[model samples]
Target: MHFHNNGNLFPLYLDIRYSFNAQSLVPFFAGAGGIMLDFSELDDTRIFINPSAGIRYVAANRTAMTFSTGLMVITGGPNARKSFINFKLGMELKRKSL
Candidate 1:
């Protein structure tokens, strides 16, 4: 998902993240994504780079929580190059053993 001056844009994005300290209580990760934002007026295609870093923690009950923050560089139509910060939080629950 992408946000810019016009509004929200649903573009195809690909990103990869690397994590450190897999067995630790708290893990750190960094990732970067590439996306193309289309401009109808300018009739051009622009590539936006989104980079972020985050931390993840797993509780005793096997519930995981993650918090990430990144910046999205959007290059829209003419004279429209902006940068916005994006923050995301996620949670995951694991199933108990039988």
Candidate 2:
């Protein structure tokens, strides 16, 4: 799960992983869509959708390096619709498989 914020906009997402055993690599696709709750005003709430794809490389031990990119879209609220692209580089850890 991940959370991102920009001013009054808050975006949340979940990531699922899949592995290709033959190559010892993982390829993943995820959706970033969730309900936005704005305490300041109910009318300001919006729904968001973001989609992304990426690949992971296991370097050593239980650690891996990841690179991914995605697009973010939001709808609802008075002229509040917006869109953008996001790129990220990160690392993750997993139990070493026997």
Candidate 3:
């Protein structure tokens, strides 16, 4: 994850995820803005609260793909009021191995 300010000072955040099996996954979320969480395999719920961009790569069963997402927070600055939400999705291959 990465964030940039008015002076182009980019602060980065990182998170590591590990899968134990097909039904169990654990993630250690971390960031530069003092954000952290330990997510378990309970209904596949993950949360992030930061103003930055991040990329996640998942590889399994000899296949790999990437997922990306971004976060933003709008503060009442002297310039204007900005509030928006964005989502992205990408697929590498779609087939059945039989």
Candidate 4:
């Protein structure tokens, strides 16, 4: 967390991955994809790669949760050479079965 609020960046990603034992209670995943970085400041606009690995869990109700940790190598744009080690948590709501 930073005290400065001037830095605003939005990294839009597909969050795609290959899952192992997809139907199991605990599934492992790993993949990397191109990401688009959106920043108001000047400089480069190039696709960045964030390789990640994590586990996902699905409940009986079809709701799911995820935990991930990865190094996001974002070296473009202002304050150039930008990279971060991040931990992420995500959720997927239950949807109607097809």
Candidate 5:
């Protein structure tokens, strides 16, 4: 889950993910959805949906490198409904499975 804002708009989202079993370069898929709101008024809210795909590489110390890309669809807002492509890169710590 994540929240982002740039003074004018606020975006809140949650991602459902699944990782594939692999020795290295694990691939995953996610479906995400949430709301985007104009900061000035509560009435200006848009529902957003996203489906994403990514790959992950785990390091020796449990740190993982991740790269992902997706498309986001925003509906029902004051502005015209729109869609955009998005990309992200980040690192995460993974817990060992019991």
Candidate 6:
């Protein structure tokens, strides 16, 4: 899944993620980002035009985890780029939802 200042980039996402088939599984990682091609309004569900990136992991039918990293260019707020890098680790039974 992807989102930007305009709205959700992709409503649904699916991928052939890789994983380690073991008692303690290894997850698959994925990431994506790009610059805005046009301008738009901002709201509660909108993110301003800025450099953005995100990472996600999925364990073989067991667990799924996701995290986002990015920089926000605020208007006269702070002449700084809001950056973040996070991670998520969780367990899944029948299906993954983390």
Model 2 C-alpha lDDT per residue in residues 1-98, reported as the tens digit of each score: 22334436544545455554535477877666786766656676778887888778788877889887889787886656889898879987887578
Global Cα RMSD, each model: 3.5, 3.8, 13.5, 3.7, 3.4, 8.6
TM-score of 5: 0.78
- Name the lDDT value of residue 46 in candidate 1: 57
lDDT of 4 by residue, 1-98 (tens): 12123554555556677777866456565555464444554344445667777888886577888898888676555446567788889898977889
Q: Give each model's whole-structure lDDT.
A: 0.69, 0.70, 0.36, 0.64, 0.80, 0.37
Candidate 2 segments whose C-alpha is farther than 4 A from its true place: 1-7, 10-22, 95-98
Query: Which candidate would rank higher by lDDT, 4 or 5?
Result: 5
Ranking by lDDT, best first?
A: 5, 2, 1, 4, 6, 3
lDDT of 3 by residue, 16-97 (tens): 4433334222222222233212222222222333433434344554444544454543332222434446554544454686
TM-score of 3: 0.28
Native-referenced Cα lDDT, model 5: 0.80
Query: Lowest summed-lDDT stretch of 10 residues in model 1?
Result: 37-46
Across 41-97, the per-residue lDDT of candidate 6 in tens digits comes to 222222233343344455556565544444443221122344444443444446445
Instruction: Provide the TM-score for each candidate, comma-separated.
Output: 0.66, 0.70, 0.28, 0.68, 0.78, 0.29
lDDT of 1 at 88: 88
Q: In candidate 3, which residue ranges exceed 4 Å CA deviation?
A: 1-7, 16-48, 51-60, 68-70, 74-83, 88-98
| TM-score: the better of candidates 1 and 6 | 1
Candidate 2 vs 6: which has more lDDT: 2
Query: Which regions of candidate 6 deviate over 4 angstroms?
Result: 1-17, 20-24, 32-44, 47-81, 95-98
Query: Which number leads on lDDT?
Result: 5
Off by over 4 Å in 4: 1-7, 10-12, 35-46
RMSD of candidate 5 to the truth, in angstroms, is 3.4
Candidate 5, poorest ten consecutive residues by summed lDDT = 1-10
